[model samples]
Target: MFAVGFGANHFIPLLQVYREGMASSEASLTAMVGVYAAGLIPALLYFGRLSDQIGRKSVLMPGLWVALVGTLILALGAFSQEWPLYLGRIIIGVSVGMGMACGAAWIKQLSTDDPVAGPRRATVAVSAGFGLGPLISGVIAEFAPAPDFLPYVIHAAVTLCALWWLRAAPETQEGRGVGKRKIVPPVVFTAAYLLAIVAWAPWTFGAPTTAFVTNPSQIGIDSAFPTLVQGLLAFLTMFSSLFIQPVVAKLLANGPRWLALAALGLTTTAAGLGVAVAAALTGSVWLMLITAPVLGTAYGIFMVAGLAETERFADDGELGALVGIFYSLTYLGFFVPFLISMLVTGAENVFGMDPTQAYVGVLAVGVVVCLASIWPVSKAAGYGGRS
Candidate 1:
């Protein structure tokens, strides 16, 4: 699961390198990521259900195999610098979709010792992978030869180790029988889910696109710096999730407060991103780094909070279905950048703004969207209830 995240996100900062190194169009750059989400969304829905019947390891090992292949393809793409990049991303997306859906469920089932232990470990593994992937890629891309090629090679090696671990791991779902299940959205998951989804949108989907759209290269920063900055964006967002989970757990120990905290997380992400955008507009790497802790904390808080809320609404029969649905919705954030890239292009042509300015405009709009939700989210969280 951790390797899945590592491979999935490691390519984020490399978008800049691909753009400049190969002279790829901005549209193609964003499309690369968009197509990934396109592949992942469907795979999540399909595979999560499939795992129930076939057992966890059946789904998990294959997913890791596919991920290993996908990583190799990505490395080849970096070497060849052509359609392979697109193909690699789509393949990786599919692999991650399977890995995340099945791997998380597997972790939960195996954690019979403690209920909370499963989620905590799974979240940390994934979050740490998400944060470190880009940072690892960026460091290699910055300092090493064949920057693009080398990073994927390292990831491929890591994927092999994951495969080995999965093979040795025990199968937790033994007595369960395979049955067909439909992914109907739960009734209890209404406005609250929507609010959480909205709150999560900015970071899960918005951050990477915003970072690349406001490309530091446009403002005369070295090519490597943009890569580092983009990596930092991911590093902070995910790492914060890892670091802050325990704190969030302690803070929201009672009631349905996680939903409210999720809302607050989104609100903070919006505000912090606004400052980060301003920093981007000025080509100030320092300012961008400053915003990392805030973004990371928000992601950590909102993600766990939202998950806690979702767990409450799930019935045992359809717990996996609900988890699948929740994740599928959140993963929609992956495509947000692609759509924003298109909008940024339009804004450049129609509004006469540079990429940085257009990104700032988009981010400012995001802030408004997040701000508007606070009241409703608070209300849903029973803000005025017995304190």
Candidate 2:
């Protein structure tokens, strides 16, 4: 799971590399990120359900190999073209989507005796992978020989080892899977369940997308390393949850489940407002610095709460399918930066505002949506006993 995830977003920090090398426009560069969700959504829908029927390892092995192929494609075409990067991003998404759905179910079953620890362990693995992928990719690109190609080669090597390691883990689902599992979980049809996803999932990635993708570009600074600022922001936002989630988990253990989710909604609302402020203000680089951590904090809380809640909603046969559905919704936020760019261009042509000037209203709408999500999101988690 970790290795697959590491390869998934390692390309984020290399935005400058692709932008300059291929002479890609900002819209196209951002599209590379958004297109990942395009591939991920389908994989989540299909491969995750396939895991339930065939066993986790069966699906996982092939997915990991596909990830290596994705990296190789990236390495081979690093500076030579533009379309391959988009293709690589899509393939990486497919592999990571498989890891998220199947690996989470696998880990949870491995820790079957303790339900609480199961989701925690999965989130830890995922969050760590998400954080470290960009951090290492950026550093290696900054100093390593063959900057255009070396990073992908290193990631492919790590993934190869992960594939070898994966063979040793015993199959948990071979003989144990429930017969006649549905491709889609029934729980997802419930209004409360849909509300949870609607209110929490999209914004889970939205916060970080804004933090690392949009924030860095909005606040310019003089730096020798092209990827350093965005890479650090990615690391900081992801790793912040690694520390904060355990505390939030402990809090949930001691208090009501709804509190964690309520906090998620509140923190996400705060993050949106902060994003709007940063977007609207001039020379708000420090504000971007501060907002990134808050975004990370929101992401962490949602991970713990969302996973636990999804686990709670699942029956014996439905775990992987439910997890798949949950994750597919989360990646929708990756399109945010792309949308922001499109809106900025459109607003400039129609309203006669520059890109930065158009950001204010676009981000303000985001803040409004975030603010309105609070109650419904909290209510989905049984706020006031309403679930």
Candidate 3:
């Protein structure tokens, strides 16, 4: 929850800055918001497996402290210049990478020996965190007096409380108890890793859409409406994860990877179509609002399916490293679209398209990617039917 909240609070503010502060030509402002993912990939590569050797708590606690500092840096930077935002975001990327790698493992360790429950709990925690983070931040930023300072201050407090809660949580791993494990070099490419990468595009593209549609200038939508839509989207995504994850796990328990991949493809394609249609009918925020939940559900399904594939293919000893790789790729998707929007803004002098058109284009591309990949992903996962 803390990790999710941290991301939500910090991530949206950066987007708000891009929309409000910097000129459209300065795509760097938007790009900077996601550049942290670049730093995260390296950190995940280098330190991902260390948690498996040491204990989850040992790594997670320190990560939280770093995140707290990052929040402070971000808050301070908001008052100063944009460089602090970049620096703070990088720190946050590292912190979140560490937390995801270790935190998921910790949740799994704490679950009763049910293999089903372990992954389900991890899924729930992640979804809940992601949902809560942005929802709370959006609400606070929309409604609260000190939009910039208050959000991070609240986040810092939340992180402190999470740190306290973590102290009581039991450690998941005992180090090899011998000398430390040698650090493994980064694995840049693998078939499964590549699949995870392709699977992440729609998810990341969906993120900025939430912010864009909600922006008052771009869409002329109500300030509170976007936040409300985002909260509903978050809830649908999280709620689906809570229920659908275990079900997907059960179906794929013996490795129905192809079927799961196909489901992901279909659902994502449908969601994308919905977004495109919504864009065509831009006058109706009501219609666009309806699609938000569907998109969220599709995202949830894709996440569960992707994680299962990662888990199925990863070597037991390299679980943390493999998961970290998966996460890095996932966040890579997060960075690319923002970068694209920034670059486009620079070349074109402005994002001339209204919020609706921008999102429709994004969702259309996402749908096409998922549809095109379906056959390949299914073949790779070795599923027999569309089922």
Q: Estimate each model's TM-score.
A: 0.88, 0.93, 0.80
Q: Which 10-residue window of candidate 2 scores lowest in summed lDDT?
A: 378-387
Off by over 4 Å in 1: 185-203, 208-226, 255-259, 381-387
TM-score-based ranking, best first? 2, 1, 3
lDDT string, candidate 1, 1-387, tens digits? 789889888888787678678888766776787777777777877777677667778877788778777777877766647687888888888888887777777887777886655666677888888889888887787668898788888888888888887777888665576466675645434665555443454354454344433333333344346666677666766776787777766666654543467566767778777776778678776666666666667766666655555556655544555556656766776666667767777899999998878877877787787777677666655222112
What ranges in model 2 sit over 4 Å off? 257-266, 272-276, 382-387
lDDT per residue as tens, model 3, 195-232: 54444444533433333333222233444455444444
Clashes in predicted model 3:
1
Please give the lDDT score for candidate 1.
Answer: 0.69
Q: Residue 218 lDDT in model 2?
A: 49
Task: Residues 44-114, candidate 2: write the lDDT tens digits.
Answer: 87777877777999888888998988888877666578778888888888888878889988898898677
lDDT of every model, 2 decimals: 0.69, 0.76, 0.57
Error of 3 at 112 (Å): 3.8
User: Can you give the lDDT of residue 255 in candidate 3?
Assistant: 49
lDDT of 3 at 349: 48
Candidate that beats the other on TM-score, 1 or 3, i.e. the better one: 1
Q: Answer with 2 or 3, whichever has the higher lDDT.
A: 2
